[model samples]
Target: MPRRHDPERRQRIIDAAIRVVARAGIAGLSHRSVAAEADVPLGSTTYHFTTLDDLMVAALRQANEGFARVVAAHPALSDPESDLPGELARVLGAWLGGDRTGVELEYELYLAALRRPALRPVAAEWAEGVGALLAARTDPVTARALVAVLDGICLQVLLTDTPYDEAYAREVLTRLLPAPGTRDGRGPGSLPPPTAG
Candidate 1:
């Protein structure tokens, strides 16, 4: 037999790994399972990923892009003068509203990082990426805080099966922003006390 030329084999395997995780979670992800899901020969998966961790890293990296794409589609998120909190809430709402499976799948793989050291960097990348996007409009501290709040909100909604309240999210996110004329939500905006006579 001759060798085959499948340029997309690697990507297919990654996609399959995501599907497998979505269906059976990280516990069910293996080269054999990914091969079956990808409809490729078992050897292909092994050739592309030397270990289960390698496959998981690839799948998680790809899954992290889902929310990034949603954020990218919303230009307001990057605009300094825009209602950043509202935009973030709207973007989150859009992400959570569309393709519930994808949102859940992304979180599942992301949360798996808690147990798998190999996945920690990939999970951090997601937060750093979003934080960077937000950093463009606010101080880095606030940007990071926004990411943390967003993560908490998402987990709460997913875990509790509660409907996403865009209004509440916006309010909370807005509170994270630095006060007007202040920097990093500190005392910069406060008027100094009158000097003693």
Candidate 2:
């Protein structure tokens, strides 16, 4: 009899590990812990990953993939400078927030990296890739600053219980935006069509 490939099962365990980390913190993770979450045999965890190091790396990749998706889905609006408070608010509202998605899981992996040195590179890549993504969206001089604040906002909101006001986020984001009609890395202003009269 042919044995069915449990590649899907292995992925299922990795996803479960991320959620477990999100809920219980990575400190609580173990073969048993993840296996319990996935309702799989302990041997399966060993079968898929020979060492805890392997498992942690796999989990980090999973987290990075998810973060990439969120970033691609919600990019900041172009020309934040020209947009008034209303348009600014709309853009921030649609942006990737701290806790709304699973920022917690990613942060937890960050902590885990302190214990697992191999995971650090993967985690660092996540930060750099996301930073570059935002920076590329804005003027060269301000791009890094813009990315930093947006990332900071997510970190702040995650640590709190209070509601995050979209309007307020925009205000903060507005200050972070480049001056209106300023040129990018490319030369002079590249203006868009005029809005309705």
lDDT of 1 by residue, 5-90 (tens): 98888998999999999888777888899999999889999999999999989988998887778878998777776777778888
Local distance difference test scores for all models: 0.84, 0.65
Stretches of candidate 2 exceeding 4 Å from the true structure? 1-5, 75-101, 139-141, 178-197
Model 1 earns a TM-score of: 0.87
> What tens digits encode model 2's per-residue C-alpha lDDT throughout 1-197?
34357658988889888877878877788898899898888888888888877888888888878756654554443344434333434444454344554666776676578788999998778767656655545554565665566566666666774545665555565566566433332222332332311
Lowest lDDT 10-residue stretch of candidate 1: 188-197
Provide the RMSD of all predictions against the true structure, rounded to 1 decimal: 8.3, 6.9
Alpha-carbon TM-score of each model against the true structure: 0.87, 0.68
Top candidate, metric TM-score: 1
Candidate 2: give its CA RMSD in angstroms: 6.9
Clashes of 1: 0
Cand. 2 Cα-lDDT? 0.65
Worst 10 residues of 2 by lDDT: 188-197
